[model samples]
Target: MSEEVAPHTHFQYADARHQAETALSGMWLFLASEVLFFGGLIVAWTFCRHWQPAGFDAGSRETVLWIGTVNLFLLISSSFVYSSGLAFMEAGNAKRLIQCCVATMAIGSLFLLLKFYEWHIDISEHLFPAGPFKINGADAGGARMFWSFYFVATALHAAHMIVGVGLVGWIALQARRGAFADGWLTPVEVIGLYWSFVDIVWIVLYPIIYLVGRE
Candidate 1:
């Protein structure tokens, strides 16, 4: 494989291996904090659900299961595409790496669009907690609380996806400029780790929010 000149900033590192290790470590440290943040929310939701089983189920049943499932599929597909991009980077195939990055971004954007549509439907159905929320045949207060957690959790997750999509697009542009050449693909790998974490968080959130009461 051909080697391009390393950037001056990278000169601080002894070699590409060390630089990549440091970058990945930094990303994991950041994600650890995110884990704690989201974990708190999950714990709180678990307590609420345990306290109000009937209302939570009624609220969960009201969710559009198909949309949630589709969103999950899209997120997982994006992660796969991103992993492929990482492999392409390892093989020094910049062209294929760029393609994978763009594909991942497109998949992530579609997930966000579907999310907005789902939120619109919820708003129309009087599901927004701030509004006069309505869930027929469920304890109104408990149902309101359920929707409150639902919107807050999903909205935060969607925001993270939007950020991830933008990061992937930026990486694609950089790849087009040949910045990831010469095994200097640490940035791409770091971004992939962050994106994967976001995807995993959603995977956990989905079952709690959508599949909890579907028995």
Candidate 2:
């Protein structure tokens, strides 16, 4: 019986293990940059909220709480499912790995669907901070600012979710083709890191968008 050979390492790497470590390190660096980007947005939001607490609170109150909460759960669940897929790959269970990837994709898709619906509702209610805006108060200008931040932040996060869903689907297709059977699971691990990072971003955004100023 011949032992299975791992996937070929790129010429730039010393070996398969070296290649994997390099890939992981690259992902971490990418995510670190992402952190700074999102952190800037968060800081901007905090400053705006502090300046217009009433308006921020009103804008937050208009958000669809149930949809945001449910989407949060979906993202969290998708992350778990993707991680389970990684574990299955490590265990050499290609079938289960494929199943988990598909599940994660489905969950991510549902989250996007719900988010779109929520956006539709917000638009219809004139919550978009544009012409015919619904939020009017002593601090209507502040409220408009809040809605601007809301749209920008949530739209960015949703874009990330869209990418994550596509990646998970791709991973599923690759797993079905037995691409990771030889223990060359670097792709799976890297995608997992990306997916988890996106989920964590939403986790941070959830409270700021939904729970924080609603009281």
Candidate 3:
């Protein structure tokens, strides 16, 4: 019999294909947990929407619909940036990877700008939940409840965006130093998955928060 090929596995860094598959598997598992977490919010939203349909609808109308719509587009574009970034990193194009990171962060910043403006309008109208929550044109208490939920949920979403921006910044720095030049693109790919998941959360939030009451 021929000599056996002893287990050379210890000398090998993990199999690249196996590593990528594992990365994707872990990401999907994490995403599943995220879906469940957000699912609870949707359930609560449904209950409120059922109880106070008019109020919910009216509150949604009060929002600058165009603002939320534009933000949705911005996030979708950012997801593309992160996706392309992953492609570039995998293909060993460090410069392109950095470009992608910049683009993603820029788009995320645009979302925050629009969000801040929306908050400004709401606050100016004495429509903030904590203090003056008077809507001159609707059932004030219901409107207050509606805006209360709106403020809470969207604020949380914005905080997540902020965190995404920070993570992307760190990714950018790593790319600049040729950190991903070798077969070490795993971290970048995993973080991109996280960024996309964050974007997906907002995708669901946008419609529920802004489209529920629209005619």
TM-score top scorer: 2
lDDT top scorer: 2
lDDT of 1: 0.88
Off by over 4 Å in 2: 1-6
lDDT of 3 by residue, 14-102 (tens): 66666567777898898898788778777887887788777777677788788999999999999998889889778888899899999
lDDT of 2 by residue, 93-145 (tens): 99999999889988988998999999999999999898989977686888888
Deviation of model 2 at 160, angstroms: 0.7
Model 1 earns a TM-score of 0.93
Better of 2 and 3 by lDDT: 2
- Model 3, position 111, has a per-residue lDDT of 97
Ranking by lDDT: 2, 1, 3
Question: Per-residue lDDT for 1-215 in model 1, tens only?
Answer: 14433562355677668777988999999999999999999999999999998888888878888899999999999999999988988998999999999899889988998999999999999988785777755477778888989999999999999899999999999999989786778789889999999999989999988899978
Per-model TM-score versus the true fold: 0.93, 0.95, 0.86
Error of 2 at 17 (Å): 0.2
Steric clash pairs (candidate 1) = none
Candidate 1 stretches with Cα past 4 Å from truth are 1-8, 136-138
lDDT of 3 at 24: 74
Pick out the ten consecutive residues of candidate 2 with the lowest summed lDDT: 1-10
User: Where does candidate 3 stray beyond 4 Å?
Assistant: 1-20, 136-138
Better of 1 and 3 by TM-score: 1
